[model samples]
Target: MDYGIMFQEENESMKERFDLSMERIGQIISEETVPQPFRDYFVRTASFIRMMGEYLRFIESGDQKKASIEVLKEWNRKLYEDILPGHKAALGGYEKSYADPAYAAARLGEGYGRLFSYLYKEIRGDIVFVHENRMKDITILNETFIEIYNMFEDEIPEVSTVKEVLYWFVSDYTDHTVSYRVREGLDPSLSFAVDIIKNYDLNDLKYLYYFGEYISDSELKTASFLNSLPEETVRLMANTYTEGYCRGFEVMGRDLKKKGMVQIRYELGFERMVKYAIENFEALGLKIILCRAAVWTVNTNAGRKAGYYSTSPNRQYEYDHRYDEAIYLNKAFKDRKAAVLKVAYEEYKELAAAYAGPAVMETFGKEGFKPVNKPEANRLDLKQEKLAVEMSNESSRILKQYVPGDETSFTIIAFPVPEIGEDFEKIFEETIAINTLDYEKYKGIQQSIIDALDEASHVEIRGKGENRTRLTVALHPIGNRDRETNFENCVADVNIPLGEVFTSPRLTGTQGTLSVSTVYIGEFQFKNLIMTFENGMIKDYGCDNFENPEEGKALVKQMILKNHDTLPMGEFAIGTNTTAYAMAQRFGILDKLPILIVEKMGPHFAVGDTCYSWAEDSPVYNPDGKEIIARDNEVSVLRKEDVSKAYFSCHTDITIPYAELDSIETIRPDGSRVSIIEDGKFVLKGTEELNLPLSGV
Candidate 1:
């Protein structure tokens, strides 16, 4: 019976219902039915909703009469001003309003206040969508809030009763939210990004405001900087990025022609580069999908942003709300989400089938964030934690069904943001140089390192001066030593600025203590980080990030271990990019470099999934035409019987900087040892060329 027509009719009915619900809410806000403080809160919230509704209509009507540069700037500022640092501290605003959970619990009931805060935060995230004329989402959330408000009008329900209603709201709407998110990831037809990039005059800074992302000074300066660069420079940057992505497919032996679309994820300010990249990908017969990072908590995983985004207005606010799913997550909710995700993928099976993979442009050099642990933040219990992991596994399985992992390949490259320092331009130029280093030279140098590694039964690494790292990494045995190699001779392909030969090590004999004096991972800085491995899996881990030792351990668990009690050491490699290391040391920006580049600056170890991940069976070969055999380790081999237990879906690389290295040696079965590096300098006979960059340091 024409499901599309039926769905349209249902959508119309919902819109009508939403209007009536909001009208009733507005009336309720006028009447002082609830107590004084609660009434004040309702009035203020309802006023904001009314303003949003008006703004939604204004934009939907194509009212470009007021979309001039100055007007748009004011509009963007007004929209985001409340959450900006100074304004967020103002009295009775959104931030200060929900600042204290205990105070809220006292004013409202314990459960009611928590639920209300969650509702407000969720609604706040939808403001951008509302302005974009995507009202279906905001309508549903508003309708739900109205339903709960109606229940309070006549009588305030018990705390359990209120909590149950909130839970059911999330449970019932899971299908809608989950499906929309999955579709956004797959379907390029929803071209919010394409329209902006193609239709707007990019030279006019006003276009940046149309995205509804919080535009910071970094974004402004970045856009201006790109505008100031010659067209050739922009094209060069784009060419390198797109070429790296194409090479990834070639290297992995995947047919790029079979795929019709590619996902483009980057920070907002780099539109010039992204625009050129779009043209480049189109030249390769690929359409681009530019989705935004997840706005709703249900759609977010492990608090990492994906897709195109701007610099966050408040990292602490994001951290404070990362685990909001704890309010409603359960086995039932998990099952419901899994079922909905399956349906969503099935609906978009055709698009998913043609999906290539992500081409990501990561940015770094933001201010280091040290999050203050707030008691008000949600924390997942043991059962919920287990459910979260299972849910991730199940979702991945569903995605793999349509978009086969072996068929898709991805490339990641990073650039520095303006926040890096006064030397931002110098560093930016150096980064481009680093990214476009002579691949032929690196190919030859890395092959030498890999050749020496192929003869080793295991490799030992030890740290120098105040750094106490010591470890043994077991290499895969070569049955036909004349033709096979354990490590891949990696250069600038999937991983740009790449200068490393890496392998999935045999886990049985890999054991050690890995320590770093200081490092910045993701958005947080770690001090005196240490991890102990027994048979390759993390046996113990800790850092001195927080004053309390237990808090520090918790940070390690959440960030590196990724909530797993233990994860296997999946990868070990020797970084051959001493040039990058020297540049960072010269500029004093080592701590600000992203892992995409930093991982190649020294000997590094990865925990959790191997670099191969779901593509263990995919044949990969080096330049010399030898298949890399070390794709799967002890844990990944479990995929034959139980796929869920086979993958942890997280890989965190912890690197030992060259300054900390004492020595790295390859030990053969006959007890003969060949040294690759000693006292942080390349001492291997054939690889001495790498030391030229570090000469006289």
Candidate 2:
């Protein structure tokens, strides 16, 4: 079933529109009516568009796959060179790329800078459209360019006129863009990426160029490294990853057979492991939906990617464009987007219902990225910010209505990329061991911690040395100590290589400050990250990421609090994977580990939503038959009344390394204390075995 053929009539209609737009765009390159600096900008962009026209022809004629590796590399570079760091018109110190908001502000005046810059980025989506053979998408984008260029044909057009064109472009095209994104996530038949991964000669490495993403040494080396490994080793990697997904279903008591499809998200370099993973998933009667990450501004999120992708050529480029929606976002547009989203999901209700959620393969080890807060970038204003929050809440509700989060589960496993310095191979091997650790062993040790916690009212965590974390997390009262538990004895299931016992804390009494010397969450790094909490919700938070204190606080609020003024302390857990801690210490790559591995190395606290955000009603239990009952807190409890206020739609796990810990103790109702960890080593009687790995470090 080639889904592309279904749109043949639509594509035929779009061909005339595409050709007319291209002809008009070609005329803009020679036109003299537009003004000076802005005229050159349009001319350059028109040239790029014409270049993509040629590339599209090459791809449509089937020459791309038959071309040599060097030819493919040349095409890929030509498409992306204008924005790559050191290129003639790329972003950075002196390069004034049209894609850079700052550069746009400098070259054009501030009034029309960001608008044109975003337009350039929007046009860049042609690379994706051309590869996917989405002629309608390419045609509409060219039409948008021509529409804007027409304004310049006359005397200097009003900024309002230029903005009106962009605003309507986004508003009118919401149905097409948003619908395709939804369909891509749910429909396994939309198999652009699946065909390449399953049928291409992965050993040749030229298959890497087929995706049209920027290929870096990191991607090339990762593919080469995996290819060099034994077939058995590759199978072990795939088995560990796929088995983790199955184990998630087994542990949660969810029937995997009920689901028909699983979304496999990963970096571009792991096709070999992903190939085996595809077979393993298919054997379990699950179709694989391999969607590419969002290329359209409407579908992309800030500094986070959800589908298959490659190493970013420039993190700052993405960071600057994080809030590109501010140009046209209003209450009406927000409402329009919400309506389109609901309809899109309704159209694919069956596929959404059968969705098993994402099986994510993550990679870490890149140098920690510290984003610069550029003054010229577009930002959501106060009213727009409020609207953005409202849209987020509405969108979550709409999604849950179709694909209930409680009905599905996810598994995330991360490995190292080549960017983690000299110990890449050694660290990779250690990561495999960490991922496939003795699940039964950690389940027993974590159960002991849970037993102690279940008897307590709250837990006190104190950070030693430079880490200034002093927080008290109130636990849920267990009704029957014999059959109920506050903390869940987690193993390598949903969270791979897991070693934590966690519970949703009671927000009424939970309060204090959580501070870390340095941490990496998502694509940004925080320096001396600190948050003050009152009643388990963020009261005040600040970081040293920027020179100005306000800027630092804004960064924390944007990234951690997720635009919400305050977020509840959703989870409290003790990480017992000292072996993972030792490995990070030994390799001197503490900052390079992903949260999936880092969360297991120490006691971590999560904010926003609990581990069981939308699935609070789903029964979960520890290994010893005791039901883990603390799934929801005060915020989540509001779901019974107002679903809009129930969840924050985000969860960020911040871990405190064992080396930074002073002690963690549980306080009983009678004011008695039981020390679980003292001076960074487990002091509990039955959990002493976890400390063996700490001794080696």
Candidate 3:
């Protein structure tokens, strides 16, 4: 009856029994742990099983409900604070460990890895075998165990049972597990930091131990840096993020008061800022949801993006496993995940719809992650790619079914962490100042440029210096000056630290070459990256990130284009964040700036869905009521005929730095071209203020 607290009830005796079992497992590992290289693995596997029990306790012991937050924090501290650092160190040794196939087999053979992996995958997969009970879903959890148990016994089961278990797991839990595993998806009260910060002293290093996230110099340095900055700086950072979130509701014309939760996704270093944002959201009647980076299955590393997470221990390992699902993914799994997602959404429909959206803080600049190309590390086969595309499209549809596009609005803001370089602090301050720039003045000035661009049928942009990029983007027609505008007058709120004028370019006439010298899209870097566009879709692409040209193309497909054969040029924008660009140049860390900041450094284009891909029907006003008619182009409007084909689910901004640009000219229907920026400086009369930083620096 109390199955909800099944693992929670592990008493001292039960824990002792687990310990003994682990000891025996460990002894077996030390003896038979073949290859000998995996000695350390068998060692850690034992610890993992033991530690998970601690987590199991706080999760189920409704008794610790009062101190549960602190308990959970302590449990996490054990994971991140205590274990992760050493785990990172041990990983270096693992390369040598795995070299010995015998040891690798022995270590993996310990069966404990399979056990926890099974438990994690199964329980999280949303098995509600005990569905009539109020505690939690047990049916779904046991199916995973049964699979692992079957595997553990080395006994093959009937094909139908395996299929049934997987179907229910994927179909019932993709959204639920995805939303649960990461805060951005749903489950608001899970902010890992909120519990830690509330229960421990911010000034105490001991406090870091409770979070269960990896603790390292980077995390500690980040926390120390923000704590040392004037409280005003921290408040400014929080205000920029929170105000933008509130403004998202305001801009979308959605009622903020009705939304009960706000999802906060960030790397571990910014807990101080997150702490403030959590409080700020609370004041707005919104609760905080904080989930971890995907670990179990179903939703692990997809690409450059990870939801709420700490710095990665090994980015290359992640890169290798990004497509690990290819091993078992099939039509049945896809249908199952979709089905689980539907069932889970129905089960948590109220929570799903109530989720306001995510307030994201993305980080950049960690030794410019150059991933090694691993050929043997499983990849998604061609068949899997099609199925994956269909699955994701269907998953998105099913998710939207519960949390309709019209009801939710989200915002993203990014900042660089200390890992950027020696000048991390200076870069951070400059970034902060740039985020809080005077939006009122820019708004008026942006309106003038927007008015001029509104009259253009097409815009021509040419690259200067070594930059070979030359492109043309077509604009939508506006019969009335009062009703439509070519570009959205982006100010500070919603997209905090704002600095861009963006529009959904007309796909029919938009054609030319869009290229950048070097840019970071998610995790991978593109060198001498070039994409040719005809009728707005990427016609051809090539980059020089890897020595092998085929590898280079594959990297682009995997990281940038996301395996899609082609993507339409969804957005064209002019970034007015010159001040921020100046700071980056001043600090000599231009490559270190995150896209959130870099996208505002120059005119950038996004090749995928437009900014309002899903919420196009939701009216969006840019302070002034001029309806933004540039919401849909040829590609996205395909939703009317086939929803799956309409959205590409990717929006990557590639910026051409101000110094690299030759000029931007708005071409009118009368054959006259008017210059908005000439020779890398704002020439539009009203936008001269944008050049202040240029002269000052």
Candidate 4:
């Protein structure tokens, strides 16, 4: 029913209000009453906002669709020009706008400068929202900034007064932000992505400029490459993606018919694949919910991008602003956010009920990012850290209350980007082959390892060749040997290009050190990463990624431990995809592989929540008719008594390469041992087939 037009018409009054707010912003920019430094700040910020407003008007004008390729490229460049790699330094004013809290506090007085800095940062991040025609958000945010600017007329306001003004501003708008976010996650009518996918002529490269993401060479090249592929190849890629998602439901024994929608989380430039995927998903009666990644500090989680995104122009910018919420985070703010979230979920409870889960397509092969630890970065203090963890747990509980995790299923797949190097096409095709590997072959090999593991009380893994990893992972006791198994014979469902049999280890006796010479997690690269565990919980962790020991430790704490005192070893698995590992080694792109694929390259351990976090109670079985029973660890089992204590809501996998691994042995209760891998080669009775790939046979 032309919902986009309908929505625009319904919000005609909002557009008028937005116009008035932009005019007000312009007036503030020229006001002479404010002091020099303060006036400068306001002028620069408001000018940026005005530019965004103009962009918004252009988008709303419907001229973007008719614009020529050059015009669209220009618009796209203008939208992200401030944060582009080469131009970022020129935009330092935006960084300095909020950067030095101490300098800001000194310049604009203790309370006022900090608040203004945060407000400026918030406004800066909302440029994309403006471009996307999220008029209400931009309008309300602009009005708040103007309201604050208006307070500086005759005299500088009291510190307490400024704090109260900002606090109330956030509190008042909490419902608006939270409710719209929740609604967008479930409502298919908010069809920015669907319209772009179904309506736009995707073959035209100009269509890539429509989404408000930074258009980089990587994205442009990726889209061009996919465009060059045959329609059958594109269809096959989409079929693999959607079929894996469907298999997730079937394998888990969940009813896909019960769910009406699935969220598509992906990188930009893969819209061609996404377009095909949308059609395939529709055939399964699932509508697409293409939500943008978190742009606002309130919605962002520890610098991770959640939804559709482009290659980050500046990783440091993201790193510096990861904890921007620390400026206003307190018990009161936390409670207010939770309350608003509850109300929002309740408002959209019906839509949330039919929500299946996220189907994630991740991209890799970018240069390893080593973030410079900026001193000006906002960091959560001890109290805020505790509160952050609590809020995450509470938020998870609230979300599960509406979209019960047991009923939902998700799938994740990864492909290389053009940045993988000169052999991008070759690597891409090899990746496709790796993803479409003989699942039945892996099933047989992994089951042999799983059967060996199930008979053991604990497995011993020791690293060879300077890797320094030695660990003992306890297995859950099998209740019925004939009908129950500890590990699931993982294939390509849920986690694509897969070859692993994993289980939540019994944490009571799981102990030792896990070390990797080099590994990439999210965007950060770690060198000489070493994590020591005592009774399955991380005891001491260190990495030589930074010159300063303390700085390196802080990085580890933020990224891996996620500010927790300790995280339990939630999962343990042996990655049997020697073919993927061989492909990576052949291309010298092992360091660039995403965890989604790299986790299947060797034995890896995940810290935080287990694979089955909120869905621990859901019964799952392998193809062999044995129910997988090792779904919960000591920590996850606490869900029944207190869910807040049960899950950490973060799972980070750290893998050790096969070249560095010594041996993996199953230690039976009868004091006998069966070696699955010896000296980095599969030596088990039925798993010799896996060694062929590593041997280059």
* lDDT winner: 2
What digit string (tens of lDDT, one per residue) describes model 3 on residues 87-191? 554353324333222233344542232223233323322211111121223323433433434343444434345445554555555665554443335764443
Q: What tens digits encode model 2's per-residue C-alpha lDDT throughout 355-414? A: 999999999899988788888899998888778888888888899999887788889999
Per model, how many backbone clashes are there? 0, 0, 31, 0
lDDT of 2 at 70: 91
Candidate 2 has its poorest 10 consecutive residues by lDDT at: 87-96
Report the Cα lDDT for candidate 2: 0.88
lDDT tens per residue, model 1, 1-697: 2211323554576778668766876686578777655666566667667767666676757663357777766666656655555555344333555423434555665566666667777777656666445557778778877777667777877867877887898888888888989988988877777778877777888778778788878888899898888999889889899999999999999999999999999998899999999999999899989899888779986557789889987776677667778889999999999999999999999999999999999998887778777666677898888888888888888888888889998889989999999999998888888889999988988888988999999999999989989899998899986677899988988998879989999999999899998777776788899999899889998988789989999888887876888999989989989999998899888888887788898899999999998889988999999989999999999999899989987888888889889999999988899999999999887899999999956
Estimate TM-scores for all models: 0.96, 0.98, 0.84, 0.96
Query: Of 2 and 3, which scores higher on TM-score?
Result: 2
- For each candidate in the order shown, give its overall lDDT on alpha carbons: 0.83, 0.88, 0.69, 0.84
lDDT of 1: 0.83
The number of clashing residue pairs in model 4 is 0
Candidate 1 positional error at 209, Å:
0.9
- Better by TM-score, candidate 2 or 1: 2
In model 4, residue pairs whose N, Cα or C atoms come closer than 3 Å (at least 3 residues apart or on different chains), thus clashing, are: none
Model 1 regions more than 4 Å off:
1-13, 86-95, 99-110
lDDT score, residue 326, model 4?
76
Better of 2 and 4 by TM-score: 2
